[model samples]
Target: MQTQRNRRGYIQHFINCKHLWLNELKKLAHDLKNPYLLKENVPEYPRPEFHVSHLKHDTERGALCWIRTDGGFKDPHRGFRDPHKWSLVWWSLAVGPEEIKAAETRLLEKTYPNQTKEQAVKQQSFLWRFATSPAFSEKSRYGSYRFTFPLQDVLSAYSQQFCFGAPPIMRVFRTCLFKKKVQYSVLVHSPANRELFSEFPLLPGNDPNAVCAYRDGRFIWRSEAMCETHRY
Candidate 1:
C-alpha cells in the first residue's frame, strides 16, 4: 500500500510541475484507464542472456571513435542517414523502490560526488527510471558507446544539453556497459523530442584533429599524430 501511495506521490509531482501530458497520466494513475494497484512480476535477477559482461568492450565497442561523441546518431528508428546519436545510456532492472533509493544514495555520494546538487538531482531522477523501468534495450545493438569512463562514474557533470524545445533542456550522461567487470548499463527510454531531430544537433562533431579515414580497408586514426591531436 505504501509503495502504491508513493508511486502516486511521484506521479503527482509531475502534475504539480505542469508536465504537458499530466492530465492523461493523472487519469491513468487513478485507475481510470488501468487498475491503479496492479503490479508487474519481475525476476529477482536478470537471465544469463541479459548479462552485460558478454558485451563487446574489448574491441571497437561500435563507436566512431574519431568523433568526440559516442557512436553517431544511428538509432535506426530515425530512418536512414539520421546522423544524430543518443547521449544517454540507461540500464533497467526490477529492483524494489527502496533499492532504487539506496542506489541513488550510493551513486550520488560515492559515484558522482563532484556534481552540483542540482546536477545530482537530475542524475538521481534518471537513475530512478533506469532501475525500475523494464524498457531498456540491449547495449550492443543500434550503435552505442561503451567503456568511455572510469569505473567509478559515467559522464562528466558539465556535459552539454540539447533541446528541441525553446529553452528547457535535459543533460545526458555517458555510461559504459563494462568496466573491470560487467556494469550492465542497458539502454533505456531516452528523453528525446522527435521534433528536435532535425533541429537539435547531436554528436560532439568531427574535430579535424581526429578524423578516421578508412585507409586501405580498415578504419584507423593515426596515433603517430597524437602530439598534433589535442582531443577526441
Candidate 2:
C-alpha cells in the first residue's frame, strides 16, 4: 500500500510539471509571433523628422516658439509641396521682460503687416469674445490669444530661408485688458494631430468670423465690426 501511494504521488507531480511547462511554452510562442508585445523592439526616442516643434518660455507660459519645418511657409500656388516630414522639439529659456519685448517687436515687424482699419476691427471683435464670455470670466483673471499654422507650410518656409542652420521661429500673442494688464499665450500642436489647430478662449459676445489680416496671417473671430470696437 505504501509503494502504490508513492507511485501515485510521483505521477501527479510529473503531470503538473508537464502542464506548467506547456503553458510557458505556449506563452513564449505567442510572444514570438507578436513581436509588438516586446517593448524593447519599440522606439524609445521621439522621431523628430515627422513631428511638430512646440517650445515654451521658462518664465512666461505665454511665450512660445513655433518653429516651422523647411519650406513650410511658401504659397501653395508657388509650387509648394508637403514634405510629409513632421517633428516637434520643445525647449525653455529663462529671459527678462525686455528681451521678450524686443523679440516680440522684431517678430511683429518682420512677419505682421501694419494693422489696417479692417484688421483693427477684426482684432477687437476677436478680443471681445473673451471679455464678454461668462465662461471665460470664470476661468481666470487673464486671457490668451492662440495662433495656429499649417505645419507643412511652416516647415517649407523654414527650409528655404535657412539652408544648414536657422534660428527657430518664435511668435508672441499678447492680449491686454484696459490697455494695462497683458496676458500671454503660445501656439502648439502635436505630431500625431498636425492637421488641426487647437482652440483658445476669445472675448465674450464676439461673433465667429474668419478674417485674414495682412499683418497677422488669418484670424477667425466673431465679426469685422466687433473686432474694430476692441482695437486700441
Candidate 3:
C-alpha cells in the first residue's frame, strides 16, 4: 500500500509539468490523475474477466477512462497507424455529472445547428445516456472504464512539430489509455473520436492544433486553447 501511494505521488508530480506534455506516456499518466491512475489496468487479463472493484456506493466520483479496441482494422485514408488504433473514452464517474449533462446539451446544439429543437434535445440526451454512465463508479478495483470509441471517431491527432511551450489545453472529453507494456502512448480526443494527428510523418508547428492534423476542422481543435491546462 505504501508503494502504491508513493508511485501515485511520483506520477502526480511528473504529470503537473507542462514541459513534458509532448511525452505521450507521461502526458496521459498526468491527465488521468491519481487513485484510478494508480489502480486502473489489467492488460494481462482479457475482457469482462479482468479486475473489478467490489466496493459500491451511491456517490459522485472522479473521471473514468474508457478504453475501446477496433479489431485491428486498417484505415485507408491516412498514412498513420494510430487512427486505426484503439481508443479511450473519458467519461465522468462521480464528479459533476450534472455539469457534464449541461455541456452535452450545448455541444449537441452546436454540432447539429440545423436540426430541429426537438431533434437537438433528443440527441443531447442520447449522447448523455451512453457517454456519462457510472458503470465502474463504485468498483473497489476496476470500474466500468472499458469504453471504446468507434472506428470513425478521430479521438486523437498528431503534430509533427514539437512545441517548446506548454501542452495544449485538453477538453473534458479528452482522456488517455496507458499501454505499460509498450511504454509508447496515444491520446484519445473523444470529441472527434480520433487522434489529433498521425505519427507517420508529422508536419512542423510545435502546436498540436497548428500542424496538419487528420481531424483539424472541429471547433475544440480549432481554437488555440489548451489546459494547465486542465493542469499541464
Candidate 4:
C-alpha cells in the first residue's frame, strides 16, 4: 500500500539522518539495562503507533522498532520467539502525552461539526469513560469514540509530533502499562552504567529495567526485580 511505503520512507529518512539521531538511540539502548537487548549494527526504522491512556484521559503517540536478538531460552517463547524479540523496542517520549492531547483535540474540532467549548469538553469526557469502561474497552470494537480519533488523525498527529517536532529519541527510563489494576515495578538502574547515573534518583520514568505491557486499555511498566519475591 502507499501508506506502508510512505512509512518505510520515514524509516529510510531516519537511516539517512542517523548521524542526527544516533546519540539519542544510544541513550535509549543504554537505558534498557539489558546489554543484549540490541544486536550489533542492527538499526531498523521505528514505526509510530497510537496508544490510548485512561489515566491521562487522552491518546498518545509511541513507537516500535524491530531489531535482531541475542538472548536464548529453553522454551521457544521464553527465548526470542521471533526475530524481533530482544531487539524489539517500544518507547514513548516523555512529552508524548501532552502533545497527543493537543493533537487529538485539534483533530476532534476539525472532524465534526463545530461545537461550543462546553460541548466539546463534555463529549471528550464521555468518550474517555466509554472507551475505558469494562463493556467497551477493546479498541478494535466499534464505538462512538472511534469517530473522535480516526487512523488519519492519528497519523497526522504522529507526523506533527515526531516528523515536525522533536523525535522521541530518548528512551523513557522506566515505562509501565496498565491492565485491570495498576501494577508497579521495583526501581532499578543498570549496573552496566550505574556509575554514570549514580546520583540520579530511581523513578519510573528513568528506571532501565522497566518493561511495558498493555491490557484492558491500561499500561503497566516495571523494572528489574532484585529479589525472588519482587519477581512475583
Candidate number with greatest TM-score: 3
TM-scores vs. true structure, each candidate: 0.21, 0.16, 0.25, 0.20
TM-score of predicted structure 3: 0.25
In order, candidate lDDTs are 0.28, 0.26, 0.29, 0.30
- What value does the lDDT take at residue 105 in candidate 1? 66
For candidate 4, give the lDDT of residue 26: 41
lDDT-sorted candidate list, best first = 4, 3, 1, 2
Better of 1 and 2 by TM-score: 1
Q: How should the candidates be ordered by TM-score, best one leading? A: 3, 1, 4, 2
Q: Which residue pairs collide in model 4, if any?
A: 176-220, 176-221, 177-219, 177-220, 177-221, 178-218, 178-219, 178-220
Q: Where in model 3 is the C-alpha error above 4 Å?
A: 1-13, 19-94, 122-124, 132-232
Per-residue lDDT for 1-232 in model 4, tens only? 0011121122111121012122333454544343432446433321122233432111222210111132211222432532224222222212133433543465466666667878886764212211232322334222222223332343345446445632212122322211111112222223444454444334333322334433333233321211111111
Error of 3 at 50 (Å): 29
